[model samples]
Target: MFKQMVIILMTSVLVNNYVLNKFLGICPFLGVSKKLKQAAGMSVAVIFVQVMATAATWPIYTFLLVPNNLKYLETIVFILVIAALVQFVEMALKKFIPSLYKSLGVYLPLITTNCAVLGVCLNNISDGYGFAESLVSALGCGLGFMLAMVLFAGVRGRMESSDVPKAFRGLPITLIAASIVSLSFYGFRGIIDNLFK
Candidate 1:
């Protein structure tokens, strides 16, 4: 049980990273990652929503969806849960953490539809993770998303200060950078296997 928990935690963060490996949440990766501050804000928001969504959805799936054989309804139910969670988090942040809400702004709402968030829940179900394991995996995956976003934002910030050709000025260069980062993450696969062994 402990070993399975560890595996889920490690894999979600490194081996099966949401951004680099699964290619989820690339929209925000390119859209809101221009500045470190914005990247950090989005990361925090994602962490909050992902963790809560996982916690909430796992039970719903286990007790409600699976028992009824309504697995086909997974996408709809998961999405509804994520949307409501994001709204709740946004309101709470605005009330208690005004600065954070300002930092996150429109991006917070955008995250409601983020495929990565939905993808995490679905992945957890597909992997047959129990409640505790799913929660850990979701947390790790959220952190991993934050890590990738911050790293990419830093790289992008540097790119803004550097000289580059006109044609490859924006997304082209960013794609190249992401490709390199993805390749680097591939190295973690072997490390994950070794850790599990």
Candidate 2:
């Protein structure tokens, strides 16, 4: 069980990363990564949402959708679940962590539409993961997102201090950086297979 859990974690975080490999949550990936503090705050929000969404939506699919043959509504159900979860998080942040909430501002609210949250929930059902496995996958997805965000924050920070052509100074260079990061992650293909071999 422990070994399988490790595999799931590695696969999610490193092998099939939501941001770098799957390209699921590029909005916040690029937006919040401008500063390390902002990136960390956003990552924590996403991780919280990922775990909560997986917990909230999985049993609904298994007990409600699967048994009732309502699988066709899986996407809609997951989206609603995630949106509600984000709203809850938003409210909690506003109440207890107003500083972070204010810092996050519009980007935080935008998490409602972050496909990564819904993607993990949908994948949990589609992959037939049990509750524990779904949680592990969510952890991986969140950590992977955090990893990419923090790493790119460092990259962007360095970029800001360096000299670059005027035309490639902003979003253009950022996109190129993202592409390079994605290409690096791509090289890990079949890594899970080889690890167990």
TM-score of each: 0.92, 0.90
| lDDT (Cα, tens digit) per residue for candidate 1, span 19-39 | 988899999888888989889
lDDT of 2 by residue, 77-153 (tens): 88888878788877888899899778655555778889898889888878988999999999999999999999999
| Range of the 10 consecutive residues with the lowest summed lDDT in candidate 2 | 100-109
List candidate 2 segments past 4 Å from native: 93-107, 187-191
Whole-model lDDT, model 2: 0.88
Model 1 CA lDDT for position 159: 85
Task: Evaluate all candidate structures by whole-model CA lDDT and list the values in order.
Answer: 0.88, 0.88
Q: Give the Å shift of residue 135 in candidate 1.
A: 0.5
Model 1 clash count equals 0
